[model samples]
Target: MADAQRRIAELLARCDLEEAQHRLGELVFDAARQAMPRNLPELAQLAGLRKVPEMFPGATPTARIQAAIDTLSLAGGGTLVLDGRILEVTDTIQLRAGVTIDGGWGGFRAAPGFRGESVVAMRRRRIDYDAAGYARATNLLNLVIDCNRQSGVGGLCHGNAQKDRVDGLRIRNCLADGWVVDGGYELFGQNFEVIAASRRDGGVAPAPGRRGLVVAASDCHFADGVLQHFPIGLHAPGAHNHFARLHAWSTYYAADPPLLIGFLDEGEGNTFMACSADSPRLADNAAPPGRENGGYGFRSGGNAINQRLIACTVQLSQYGDAASLPPPRTIIPVHCGQVRATILGLEVRDYGSAGFGPFVTTPSPAVMRETTILGGNVHEGLPTNLQLPWSEPGRFLPRLCIAGSDAGIVQARQFGAVTRIGGLAVFELSLCLGGLRAGRGAVTIQGLPDAAAAPDEGHRIGFQPVLSHWKGGEPVVAVLHGGGRELHLLRQSTGAPVTGADLTETTAISVAGQYFTDMPGDA
Candidate 1:
């Protein structure tokens, strides 16, 4: 670049004024040739890229695209501009560094993309790594990558799972699938829809754990994408990710069970806002042979530590607990996570008319930061204790759910009602949502009621039992009002994991979907 600049100056000085102007124009053209391409097509030709169709016009589009990409990679890097036609390929095409496969040649969907076997792969195929530098900042913009083959195999785009083989890759405005962000760190993308992966048999029966996206790397952000029809929508197992306005639709496979919108294992400091998940079509989805159709909207644990789901909507279709399949299915089946998770302002609705799945199953050895379900409506009921939570009088007030089956009833023209907790009768309140396990004992109001006739019970009884240690702070104790009827919804507006209960009335919180919402599992 410096030599070219110097020569242009000397050439102009030696020419006459008219000749100088003409020659200077020529010099500018020569310099521009050495500069980088201003657009995608020019970039594709950087390394002597060729449109295989033009050279062999009757050849299959698959061969043309393969030859073009391979030739471009050999020539170094560039965008081999593809026409607006669907090409086909059999094997995974290596996406090279400084290469931009701009299917949208000019505007959006310009080239549309290839429909073939596998997808663009950033795998670590460049052996002697130290000798051959890895791919960097690869961009896939404005294209449709269709990897759905009739053969029922392949991924759309696969990243290196073992090492940081890619950095700063940006994928935007593309409709594609089989995304594995495992090996790439710092992938910034938005406005992309990942269609369901290659199904085992045209989706008649599900493939094991088919995924729309697996984000194992940290510091990744995705937005405005509809991830649908996979066993899991977003499989994130790292930290510091912000997901905004993502939709997970019909997550579970018909025969396969355990469908979830997203699963984060060992993931920390993540924020999920304005996300919605549902398994609407699973009403008659019987599991394959020995499998059961069960899953959650979202699940995190296994050192998943601190995360927040704010103002999200998790609407589960009607599902039932099957016979113990190796591990027993949780009764109040959704929203179960270990450790400190703070769920707030989420709309949870169960649309099952036959059998009822609980909004949140019992907390195992794990409890959310406070399990605050503030400012949301559960069409059926809030988190119910279908299984009684372990309790010690005056120490812990367990958050309970009303079983769907027990919601409406009539007995002697009287709807059962009570607002008190004393002796063994108080311990019996946890059983109301499932079956009335009425107890025999002398009952008294354990906590003072909101009364107009009596003096204020500023000394009203309440429990502040320690639930679990906060992810980045102290052990948090859930503050119960009355006899734990309402959860004091927590406000977690920042990236830090610290949460505080401020509001008074909240209903449902997320505990656990694609096929169903999922719990966090190992990568």
Candidate 2:
């Protein structure tokens, strides 16, 4: 303990305090690393604390550990290492900046029992504005969270520090609610409720800042973890954040409500890459929207300015009703401003009953590109404002629905220039044409093998042909709209299937399909 205190004091005495703190962080991290032994029982041990489950009779070791952490925080900044027995944190453990909790070899074991609550709860409620905004001053560093908790960690992360990283964390089992920040909530009790001020109107006003992690975070990465609680996995509302190599297995909601590592607000930018989410199994009685409302894979508010979804997989485990389904809004982007989102190299399937937002309002400009919309039944049932006029004048290209999407197209009213690239086995079924306001609308198609030779079947009026793609080891079928659609199948490589639908031009039309070139052909 005296050695740790002397280290903190020496680091504080540096000329460049912040830089010194970072250097100190490296040193402390190295110490923690050296302290961890590949061989058990050789780890460091501190005095004055008893083994968790074997403490001084009635005294709770978790409480004692927490008290020690609180005291160290009040003392400014230090490290706490937990070893030996299991420490079950029944209540919230508030962590001040510059404090690192390293749970040794056995890791920190926390589970929810009796109270039926989630294990390892943090951030009891959102901090008030007058208080700290979860911001960091390089005070908190090396928060190594490695555990074997049967139930995962509950509560939004208040890690609003710049250049902070949470890595090599392993969470398994017991996932009711993953993590919620800004406007995200955990399903600790019955219903998942939003504690933000935006949700409470006619009721008792929520005490000033009584929410979750709503701080402005930057350069944070939540990587190499697994959260299996379906629906809302991890919600982040900060800027310059990255979510990589995480797996979410949700059993309650199908692909209707998607799971996410975290969500960003309008002023923030984030990227989600190389992630996977699986829906609930088909046989269970977990009735869809039996009574619940507003279920989505990912739900972003009106302020998410720029975000990207790259190389992700969202698959449904069951087949449910498409018509009598509980109006599940697939991806809800309400009144979003200037944002550039690219969803690429996606593999989606089993979800046949889903829908996208109708560009539903007048907005300035927004762009979505290189997205592969597969196996989702995008029901364009009604004409709603895509909400584009509210944005400034610019070109918006949501080049999406590359493959395996059904009825995957829409239009916004009084919108700017829009372009779409309908890839292999895609059908663009439209209702009231004005909804897809392509000021100078255009379509580009590619990668179809059937249309290159036979110009006859390319002109077929009512033939729904099945295109095959590999899934696991078996071949899966994808249906595309043929006949009546104005897509001129250029070569055998870009032919549409057969369709019973009609294609009209409410704005203006320029048809380009499947490597379709205008000159001497061979496109």
Candidate 3:
């Protein structure tokens, strides 16, 4: 028996000394007809799979899970399959390079409202990148990481600065967040839900500046995700990232000072496609005193440049009784602040009182220029004096070409020429008309500046009729009223008021002019 044991020991030691010891222990248990310990070391040798439950049997779940991870990592990196058990952790779980934790979705409880089968109930703990080491190819799959009102799993590339190029990271269905990606490249995340737990201090207001998913890294792609209950849902301070089919919902009533935006883009060269953001509801139909209370669906910060939104939607809801609510202050669907963007098929809807237009810009030191809205709908709850595609005087200039006809809004089919001189916007506007009666046609021209006064009695600007493709005589003169907000075609060649008989379904008109705008620049 001694010789047999020595041979077994020498043979096992040839593989690995520590592994040999675990094997020997298992052999002894098997020989004694007793069940072998189902510890991590033994199970790893037996099943070639590292599991959390097979760690130190008497240790806490956190320690056991960490031990299992460490053991798998020490074996040159592998997957740590989590058992369908709730592991309560009080400390952050540090992930090493090349390690993947896959808590199979099927392993967790399937009852409604169940977070997941493999749940990591974090009592202020999080799963983060290893501090002492650089992690590459680390992933979390099908795991529910509950923050319990503390921090959630993320910051994978934290403390490494932006110099490290951590790659091949993937997170799926983690149901975790406060997730910060400060440094990383090529991350592919899908179907992940980020929920900012309620504040522990029992305060109704959101923790000051609390954000759900803060991405400060570049070249990452996220899709089909939901970020809810955060002051700012998806704050992208990174560049060259793509977010597709993501929904951002903010319920925090307290204003976050300058703005409470669902999706705030301070990054450059990012593309949001088919994404939607639901603005936050006002608290008790009232905002804090001396503070503006309202939500913005999407905001492009002053530093944001070259951003693109394709077929995205933003909706602002009016909570409680609209009549009782204070005068709507800053409720805007999309606010473009000193940035260059190209928006296509963007739908902005407001369900509250009259507020800012669908797409608007406030006065800023830096100019908001080169913004192009290709196609979209701005559906407002109430008739507002603020014009569609509105911009404040002085530095807001956006080129808008609204295609397709909607009943209430002006749809400009195309723009012939748009140029700005000093603070004045000079352009030739064109509209395709199916049917027009020339007695007195009020045409809504896209890409026009807002009027300082009400549309009822606005500054009228004269425009020369460039050309028209109507069978009847074209209007010899055109007048743009309300600071170019409304265009009225008048005076036929025969000096007669052009009647509906002069126009046909295929008629098209073009007008050229330059108007003095309230914008500050060389007039």
Whole-model lDDT for model 2 versus the true structure?
A: 0.34
Error of 1 at 401 (Å): 10
lDDT, candidate 1, 1-523, per-residue tens: 3343344345445533344333322322221121122343332233122222122434443444455454445445555444433344555566655455665422111122433434566654563143357544456665565553333433545465332222112222222335677655567667766655323354442255556677777777777777766656676776777788887765243343334434333477777888877652232244311112335566665546667778777665554344212121221223545555656665655554322234443244226324443344434342222221322222233232122122321000001122232211121122122112222221111221122111211222233222222232232222223333322212223322222221112212221000101122222
Ranking by TM-score: 3, 1, 2
User: Which candidate's lDDT is highest?
Assistant: 3
The parts of candidate 1 lying over 4 Å away from their true place are: 1-67, 70-77, 105-117, 124-135, 150-152, 160-177, 197-205, 251-266, 280-293, 317-334, 352-356, 362-374, 380-523
lDDT of each: 0.42, 0.34, 0.51
lDDT of 2 by residue, 71-183 (tens): 34443334555553345555545555444555442233443442323333333223211145543221222222222232334432443233322333333222233333322
Clashing pairs in 3: 40-54, 108-117, 109-117, 394-519
Off by over 4 Å in 3: 1-59, 105-135, 151-177, 198-205, 252-259, 280-294, 318-330, 351-356, 360-369, 378-407, 411-473, 476-489, 492-523
> RMSD of each candidate?
15.1, 16.2, 9.5
Best by TM-score: 3
Per-residue lDDT value at 289 in model 1 = 15
User: What TM-score do all the candidates reach, one by one?
Assistant: 0.54, 0.44, 0.61
**Best-to-worst lDDT order:** 3, 1, 2
